[model samples]
Target: MGSCENQEFECKKQKPLLIEGPIIVGAGPSGLAVAACLKNNGVPSVILERNDCLASLWQQRAYDRLKLHLPKQFCELPLFGFPENFPKYPTKHQFISYVESYANHFSIKPIFNQVVEKAEFFQSIGLWRVKTQDFEYFSRWLIVATGENAEPMRPEIAGIEKFDGTVVHTSRYKSGSDFGNQRVLVVGCGNSGMEVSLDLCRHNASPYMVVRNTVHVLPREVFGFSTFGIAMALLKWVPLRLVDKFLLLAANFTLGNTDRLGLKRPKTGPIELKNATGKTPVLDVGALSQIRSGKIKVMNGVREITKSGAKFIDGQEKEFDSIILATGYKSNVPVWLKGSDFFTEDGLPKTPFPNSWKGEKGLYTVGFTRRGLLGTASDSLKIARDIADQWRTIKDTKNICNSQIALQM
Candidate 1:
């Protein structure tokens, strides 16, 4: 047996499983917020995290130019605000600091380095049997706070594996200083790709942006205010179609067509609105100006990776020193839970709440969807409150049952 398995076996023989009120499976912003809410409602919960510290993804995966896409006012946790001196759009470090403060304020002591491997609902016992590498714990409720960014989505392009060059995903990306003199190819046109491309250009790296599809790029700030604030205001007063039209007009006026890059304008709208909420602002950060100035080159999607360079679908071949994949991530739920077929076909949890799940009985999930702005934190609070209420009802019913039995005796 493995070391962890042997340890678990030894522990099980000496000590039985400890039944906690609820076991939260992550210690991210969502999990920490949920734990705080449960504590407020007098419900005890144990948060288990795979990382050694809270907000590891924020501290590690993000690039240096990363800042809160949402304004600080909206991104703050429940009962907490960004430091008064911090900018309206806090940097990555500032955001991580705020998360640290939130955890400290709530006195949330999550078990770090404890990865929850499996969680199965025992119908007969009416408890969730959670297993990790260290030990097993039984809880009446299970909250799967595993966020959507669990699995990094790396595309399988032809000859990618044989490229014989450096390949890194957004998760592995750290800074732009390392790409000083190399010809870098950044794949994907999302925020990360856009931001990284701009930063690399400023650092004197010959960066080429590979756009597979069209995207709506917006300014980080609008009329001296955050773009998100402006979008929210417009969304409240205007219809979605009108908003789309206005945005399209603005984008066309500001960015024009993709013809400059030897590509055609997409028939569909530039932006993707998955939720009913306002638009998620896309920061320009001088990317367009750089492209216009020839500082950074824009190319079509990659058809294949040649031995010495990459081949575009347009029959053009360009040599590159490195390729950075800004591809997205996938949800990685535990394996022991065999009933995950109920989740979205893409492996994402299906919650009663638009982005939140209607966890079975005592079970709940927080921060599964990439809702706009502070949506994850907001969803976490609601789920925590619901779980607290359910726990109370369950306790009350159990007490009443015991009382009836005692009277019969």
Candidate 2:
């Protein structure tokens, strides 16, 4: 234990780990966006991720055929545009690569495998205590960027326990080749359900889509331009109602007799549906064509799971070899937080639906409330600006206290 020999011993010993500045949980696009925004504003942040890599949800969970519903321009992160050679609608693999590149470009090195178990705010210290399984981290600001898609929500289907067929969530579904030639019932007529049904049809599987309500399915590209792009442009110049009417005309002109083809247009317009309920209409890629071609069939909502198959609300029963639930996801924030004041009983933020980013008690969330990449980008910028403003006040107060102490001495 000589002093010179002790140097090697000290080098091997574990040192106390600490992180200052802001602590961002979850390294998905939302988290990455917040971290990038903070860095650009001269504030540093440490990202803690439960998974092995950044953007694990996109890299691991998305289907092979997934593409951005919105155009690339609207989906890219703030200040970092998509690659020049990429298409208008980037594929799932391309989007994953873009996320990876975005993190690398921003020099965001997230601490992997540290799943945040609890977050507590201490008023005495004016800091947030974030505890993982193995360590404790304290931060002046806690940004929970673990967006809405972190947890998959499965609806309770009656008699599903007795069904002998394969059942899986859309998150676990990769390709349809593995489910070849099987009759697949895709529950829910959202984008994922529509796309999965189409995938199953292409792979020789008999695909049946459950459209429970009037669905607003718009063509992905109309008149050689993205319908989303056109809608966004129209939104700037016109009211939402007028924009929706224009979109309805465009849909009727492009898709042609969607009502006759089993797709009855919703009573409400697409923009209204999205704004009122955050549930946007599905942007039809090729599912509509497949449905019109008789390659894909439509069914009503599931009434019960019979021994033979599922019974729809219309008393129609059909046997399927497999059931795929594309029911969507819930945010994981309310689980990690201790109290119920911040969130509702359904785990949604009590504070408006989409403005959960403006959190209280030193807790902020980025992507939990919003719907798309553009929403994530917008949330991240606002959160960063708010955090920066608060930090400036803290610094100013500290400086004033120090000056008074020096004068007294």
Candidate 3:
């Protein structure tokens, strides 16, 4: 190992099979943020990423018109602000640029393309054995920043495979230019579905949106202020039901009631505005206008896909050239930590303290709960602080133990 400021950097010496210190899985925004913090604190850690680039979601899954639902000022990583020229709401490219900048700023050298196959904790040794495709790393702690959007979840309707048309998930959808002049069906009523549908309309594609349930859609901006500001204000003072009523009234007055199209106005609270954490209601950015203007047609959820088209649960059949499944994503945590009795009954990590993971010692998960768009970043900051405190406590305890041993000798 190499000495740095009189302390040995564990990973400096390349053993036949052992690498050291904390191991971070995933190189997304959360992973990068954690790495940056660790580096700043002089903590020796290794980040294992499955992709060659950081923020693979931004580089791959994001659509062209996608903008940060949260303002850039709040969306930035800790200690790093967005560029001066960046828009208040940055585009996908701008977000990726910011992530790259963060990595460069921190000098974080993550092992690119190193997919973690599995991880097992050696309780006796107090080390986690993380196996990748090419190498195995032993670390005292593991941070599963794999993120919630690890895998895309596509709806499995009957006869979808037989359609013989272009079937792609929103994750694979880059732009709507290719669907030009074609009849398109956007499955799901999430933000991605609405955004893609709007893009399709702009691209001259006749787009139809499949809404399975009534979604509470709010404007990105309200009363010259960000919708998130309004949400934050309301969440503090107003009751959830009252907030829902106010939002519903606003939607009806502005976007019109989608109930006539077989979708009901949700009686729930206002759409949580933060960012696209896959849980917050999709903001209705011109989708309602497009629908009302006859640019896009709203349809019920798909019952089954047919050879020619699809059959909706409402008994309506329509033919389309392409189907964009915006069904959402699945958290594949078991792939790495299978048989671990730490996850919730629903397979999510069990967090006794709300958003903080509790079952595993020296292990933590961030960005798992979809509190909203800013939820990941917010949770990341909290988790990072908590981990730092824990690390400091351990170091202090070790120092005390060493001093006591020396005194005894």
Candidate 4:
């Protein structure tokens, strides 16, 4: 109803664009999935992305050796499946291409390089004001799909600032070839840690993994079927404890007591761990083999970083040429919507990860709550259906009001 002059926030002072449908943030898979679903339901939306293109994490940040942790069937977007010729577990590049095809197939267009600097809700108008660098948008609904991996979670270690070796996060790590013949230490035993260590080994680099806590190291496949496939089938029917027990049994049968190899078996099941802590176990490709063969060494938690390398808590000091932190990332929610009651002080949802998918007050979050592509697709469908239902109700109410006014006239 009003232009940029009436907006509360101080922005670039340009004419504001008003939108009826949701203004989705981030052009990644979660954002794209929700937008496509809304469009299919006859509700158009706008996407604001900070990156140059869609799925920038997969396209630009991921390592060269990255592949889908889950099978392709489980990774497809809503109403779109991976090509028949694609691998069961598509590589990072293949997945990126599929995302591009999904966007093209749906004709979804996003405003590129538009980073939303601020967002404010106006309850009286039932609209939200979202401001970027150059423009401001007001929309009826706001969907924050900025995702969890947008910011890397770097840990502070004593003397790390003084260390002279190459330090990089997994997102910046292109390939192991760059550190040829160098001794490297990779902190954290998540998927990235395993994969990066394996890559470093392939490049003739001495890599050590720092396992600071209990970890579940699972074989990627058993009996030629993905372990993830088995979990999907049994996770619903079986109890969490039972599933954990079964997976532990399977892990032992597949890879001998990995605890003996320095990876202490976590008391909790892999699925439960992921559900609770949002940390998935390492699905081994070749990292386990190298670890078992003594090619890839394992270390305890770092006591402190030295000028050359790190000293472990076990009172062992090792010199390394570089340290690669596969330490994962935290949610960037506070950067835009800080002090909002929907999130905690740390920017995590007040409701745990599961309940975070459905938000109140015309606000919803997609990738922030979900785990993978399948979860994103499921959340997007639910969100689109909810929005469509609300739209239908408003339209019917408006029609009835207009008819009553005509009769009075």
Candidate 5:
């Protein structure tokens, strides 16, 4: 048993499993990115995933018609590119296949179904104790990649329990086919809400999209060019506000006045708002057309839920057969990772992007950057290189100590 071993973890075996590099939490894209980069640097890591398979949220929880909102180029992880044959915006299945190939290419296999109960750093020992259901993992570095969307944000609606209809979160929503021929109230205006309503319309369901707040809805592409790519290019030379103006102008010229239809624009520009608070603007695919066509009716905020329907703040009442909450997700880091100063109560790094990855006391986080997969790539590379450098220094120090002991003998 090591001197660091304590009553905190009475292992069946005396010693805890010491990882050679970092202990990466979550086998989602972010975790995989770190693991692959570590492997590239000849550092070994163990990935702990709570689910049975990788990308469980995408495969198990996401809707059937889901696809990457950003172009596939921006959505790819570190050290790998999406297949050249893939579309600019790949479908969910295509994306999953790419993930599998990426894992295979790097020979990165994660230990599945291992839920991390708690993780705390022992400063005296200069190691981290990563406790899971069955094993205790000790490592010099801990990489938290559980991600921003670790848990679904289920809002408390007034009289929700009394709502006598099919109620489910967007995570559990498989398809609109299940909601055919019913009046569905979708309580959001984000990409998911818009897409779900559009799907419902396709399935012959009456959908009322509740747009409670201002949203920045941009065309996924403008003039056959990726809107995001254009924004990135513009931001390099032009100011962010100028980029926002260009995007808004292009969106207005392309998509027409979305405000007239009900979804109003936020005073904060899309990119600026996204930067300030990790809120991503809704990238319009085909949902706006439905909203314009009046196939998807836009409604006000929900005031109260009735057994048969809902009463809006406008005092309008509509009978609905089902309610779909497209409320989005939050990080679950606070629930498991203990005694950490890296993350806030909301499970995001207190520090913002471009500097959010590396934390104190050998703690690192990926995908906490609101910047999405691009952020994952940046964090993964930096963390890998940093750990590799530190590992070499530690080995050199240990060798020096050993030589001193030999000389004394």
Candidate 6:
């Protein structure tokens, strides 16, 4: 804790650990998908997870009531499907079980608790230098699979520190039972925000959600068909506009006018808005009815947070016992990856999806594709195939089995 210890820690050096294949950073679904795909391609990779367990977001951060927004099939990783008995939309626990099984099935043994501090491609050495807490890895290929949502995106509110109430991000929130019958102010109107509010309502808590910007609220399903399913099926037949029109018409008929209920729709179509901006529309499970019945109050953005409650930008003040920030997450790629060419300042691939998976200098990105699991699968397969082709062409096996960390699987 002293200056001397800090200096020594900074001065400490790790032997350059050479990796035969690609070095993966992260052990989440994205990382798992790529690792599995790579194994299938006859190539091996080393996955490094900062956390002790795989899929920490799903295993630890997810709420008790969380379920796959999409069907299980659509959410499956690269080379695996959810168990046949698993429901169309598996619950939080079921998804975690699937993730563990997926990792085990692939024989993935990620070095746990190895936080990637920095990763840089050295043109001189023709390799990537990945520096973690315990290892400095050198490899011809480096895969950034941390994906989107690496870190919680907490908003900067005036007087937030002065608030006496228990304020926590959705990452830390597990259940509304934790708050009992307290008045909870839920910020953001995204899927997580809506679901969290719905959960609070079930727990007999008064939940107020904040709608700071325009959002698209579509029924999770429409007439025995999943809304997302319909969108995907229709996109192939018609243009995005027609698909959006049908969706809005269906939404208008099913949910009626949400504007009067304080949930405003964006001017652009849901699909269009999502394509332009990675903001996904809230797939209402039960929150719409709660909002309709006035069980969950919708309010404007907060102007300031007081000890008792928060003052809304609409010039209104209300008291609350706690605050739940469903403000969402952003990529942490920029923080550690030492480059500006491949990724943006916000930590997403500079290139868009489809093309976003591959970068120059043998660097690849998975899960940055706003397309969710489907995108992750696409990126993973492409990366694995490309790496396999390159490896076969080079036929470089001289350094194989040289590193202590061998590709066990």
TM-score of 4: 0.93
Name the regions of candidate 4 deviating beyond 4 angstroms: 1-13, 397-409
- Which residue segments of model 2 deviate by more than 4 Å? 1-18, 353-355, 396-409
TM-score of 3: 0.88
lDDT of 5 by residue, 1-409 (tens): 3322212334463247776678899989998899899889877788888998788888888899999998888998888999999988899999889888888899877877678999999999999999888778888899999999999999988988999999999999999999999999999989899999999999999999999999999999888899999999999999999999999998899888888998889999999999998889989889988888889999999999999999999999999999999999999999998998778999999988788988899999998998889889999999999999998898899999999999999
Instruction: Write down the lDDT of every candidate, Cα atoms only.
Output: 0.73, 0.82, 0.74, 0.86, 0.89, 0.89
Q: Which candidate is the best by TM-score?
A: 5
| Poorest stretch of ten by lDDT in candidate 1 | 1-10
True lDDT of residue 267, candidate 2: 89
Question: Compared with the true structure, what per-residue lDDT tens digits does model 1 show for residues 1-409?
Answer: 1112111234543233665467888777878777777777887778878888887778777787888876788777766678899987799998888889988898787777777777787789887877778777777778877677766888998998877778999898888888888899999877788788888887889888888865567566655676556656787898766766666666566667646654344444433353532223356767878888888888889999977779999999989888999877767774445554546665566554464555565667777656633666677677777877777898999999999999999
- Tens digits of per-residue lDDT for model 4, 313-396: 999999999999999988787888733588766666678755677767788888866478877888899899999998888889
TM-score of each: 0.88, 0.91, 0.88, 0.93, 0.95, 0.93
**What TM-score does candidate 1 reach?**
0.88
lDDT of 2 by residue, 224-284 (tens): 9889889999989999999999899998898887888767888899988886767778888
What is the lDDT for 93 in model 3? 88
Higher-scoring candidate on lDDT, 2 or 3: 2
Evaluated at residue 206, the lDDT of candidate 2 is 92
Task: Identify the superior model by TM-score, candidate 4 or candidate 5.
Answer: 5
User: How many clashing pairs per prediction, in order?
Assistant: 3, 0, 1, 0, 0, 0
lDDT-superior candidate, 3 or 5: 5
Task: Judge candidate 6 at residue 24 and give its lDDT.
Answer: 89
Candidate 5 regions with alpha-carbon error over 4 angstroms: 1-15, 399-409
lDDT of 2: 0.82
Per-residue accuracy of model 3 over 290-372 as CA lDDT, tens digit each? 87788888887788998879999889888889999988877777877754777654446665325554347567676576553
Ranking by lDDT: 5, 6, 4, 2, 3, 1
